[model samples]
Target: MRVFISGYYGFGNLGDEMLLDALRALLIEYGFRRDELVVLSASPKETEREHALSSFKRGNLLRLFAEIKRGDLLISGPGGLFQDSTGPWSPAFYASHAFLALLKGAKVLIYGQSLGPIKRRVNLLLVRFLLSKASLVVLRDESMSDMVPRNKLLFTPDPAFILSVGEVSGLRDGIGIVFRRWKWDLESLLRVLVKMGFPLTLISFQAEREREDGIRLSKMYGLPFLTPSNWAEALRVLSTFKLVIGMRLHSLIMSAMTFTPFIGISYDPKVRSLCELLKMPFLESPRETFAFSGYIRDIMIKWDRKSEGLKCEVEILREKVRSVFTRSLNLLLGREA
Candidate 1:
């Protein structure tokens, strides 16, 4: 059987690349051969070389359509690809592949995705219609459960939780902060970090777009800047931080996966959702005049308790994420789930 995987791949975004890695790993472990897997990517050559799989350029409609086969499986995401907040184009672009697969009689799986802040009714309608046709829809959370049929909706953890990391031991020091382009007050946040008196590092999750902001922040604040090339390197770096103040959702996910304590700075509902799911501390808006110092102080005081609790929660989530993949793949292949 042939499986065509699609997502925001080969774009130099660590989080999306990690999602592809975790999903591909799960598929292979579940009995699919490497040769049977194909990926649709922006950089086909890099995707093929890095993942060791066949690939097609995501923007080449002719090639993408030519490769679809009836009875083949199309796995459409594990990211927030259906949102219109960035623009209407993103939802339309990702949906086109799934729609094409459906038209070609291939089974479509909307795998572990987050639904919208889709402000436009037309975009919402289009997404609803696409979900209606999918053979299976597994969401990363229940926030958008209303959009999917109850019988077809199953909630699971983000696939990044399935990534492998080495065992961490001993006391960890320093603080890691991940930043993206958002409307948050950086100076105020930095004041709190300085008061906390830990060595701070600004980590870039998407270097292509975030490197400029990271460099400016590093220079202004006299902090170190790190741009990890891949997910494994990012995880390794995050594991060394005693505490991570993150703006990226996957940064917190990686921190939890490494059993490192984290505080989320929520610029989106998805970040808040992850914090709620894992029961962690988050600042809804650091831009507001909230008592930022006290918040960090409180977390530091309860550090041991939070770390132990997060480790337990991560283990439970790992099992749930694995089970979701196993059952979904079984059902798709017509075996008893």
Candidate 2:
């Protein structure tokens, strides 16, 4: 089967990239050959080079339609692709793509997606319509299940949760921070880690302002810094730490994948939800910034001893998440022949 994928891919966001990687891995695991897949990416060259998959630049309607016409299935999402809070156009863009695929007679699988805080009436209607047309809808959490037809929705953990990194036998004794420019006192948090005598490393998952913040923090604190060139590099950096303090959802997800102990600083509900799902401590940004430093200090003291327990918890979820692809494919493709 020819599969065309659509999402927030190829822009150097580690979380989305990892999701795409997981989706490709799922396709391969289910016996799809390399040439049978096509991706709609913002950076086609990077997607092609890094993923070894055929990619067409996003927003080219002609290309999108042509791909839809040629493909047997069009899979969109595994991200917050249906939300309007980001912008009015964000929901419209993703929903329209799924709509187009349906119009072209391609089976649509909305995979590993987090849908809505969609308060806007028009966007909700659009999402409802688009999802109604989908052959399968796999959600990352249970909250969105009511929004879709009961038969169409399946609740699964984030696809990235299925991503695996083996345990590091001698994990370095230090704290790793995934930094982003959020409305929180990051410097104070860094100072607290330093005062606690944990050597610091700042990791950036995006090429945007977050990378700039990571570099700035590294320089100011005289510590190591990394803006991972790819997901493998990101996973490698994450595996080295005894504890990971992360603001990005995927950073925390990677922590879980590597079985690294973590504390999430939630700037978004997605982070908070994942933290809650993993039973990890998280502080809301700005609201909890003042107490975050002390919280980190306390967690860091016992983090090493606590990691195995955390790993066990995450592994349980990992198995369930890995099953999403198989279940989805069996449902979506099994009906074909």
Candidate 3:
């Protein structure tokens, strides 16, 4: 059966790309051939080249409708695509895709997504209607459990948890910082971290805005910058770090995957939710009054214990997440879940 995968792909965002990567990998492991997989991407050429799968431009509605009309299923995300915080367009856009798939008699799997902080009544109603019609709706966290029917809702960790990384030769005894363009007081945080005397590296998770931000931060702080070309490379690089202070959700996710302790700087609810779910320390946004030094000091004092605990938690989470995907895929394909 042909499966059409859709998400925020081809936008140079490593997190979304990692979601696609993990989803594709899991689907393959679950017995789907590469030829049966199709992706809807903003840069279809790049997506096709990178993923070795069939693809078509995301904006081509005629093509999308035609594909769903003939395809067996449509996977609508493993990302936060249903929220209106970014604007109503995002919810409308993703919901419309699922709506089309259902309209054309194709099954819809709302894969590993984080549901809304969708404020607008119209957007929320439309999203709920589309979700109600989906064949399966998997949420990444329990925060929005109320949004989906209990029978339809399955909780799994982010799909990126299933990503595999290779080993790196040289491991570093330093902290890595993953930053993006946010209003947080980064310079002050850097000052506090520098006083702790460990080496610091600026790691970039995205190819565009985040890379530029990393470069600027590296120069400003006289630190080295590293930008991994893909999610595996990012995981390998993160594995070498003793700790990570990250603003990006996937950065912290990779840190956990690598068994590296991380401090999450919550700029969004998704980040905060992940941190809370993992029982990790996270500083809230607009953290001007947050006790940076005290927080770091406490984490450092408990570093070994925390790291060990995180390793155990991640392993358990990995198994549960893998099983969730396997079961969901099995059910979707008419097998026992």
> What are the per-residue Cα lDDT tens digits for candidate 3 across 101-201?
88898899999888887889998888888777889999987766687887888888888887765563255578889887777878878887887788999
Highest-scoring model, TM-score: 1
Best by lDDT: 1
lDDT of 2 by residue, 66-138 (tens): 7677348889987888887667888888877787888898899998888886878998888888888799888
Cα deviation of 182, candidate 2, in Å: 3.1
Higher-lDDT candidate of 2 and 3: 3
| Overall local distance difference test of candidate 2 | 0.81
Per-model TM-score versus the true fold:
0.96, 0.91, 0.93
* Better model by TM-score: candidate 1 vs candidate 2: 1
lDDT of 1 by residue, 1-337 (tens): 7899989998988999889989889999899999999899999898988788899889877776888889999999989989888777888899999988888899999997888878888898889999888899999977667989877778889988877777774658888998888888866888778776889999998998988888888898899999999888998899888888898889999999888888898877888899998888788877643566665667678888888988899888888899989999888888854
> Candidate 1: what lDDT?
0.86
Q: How accurate is candidate 3 locally (lDDT)?
A: 0.83
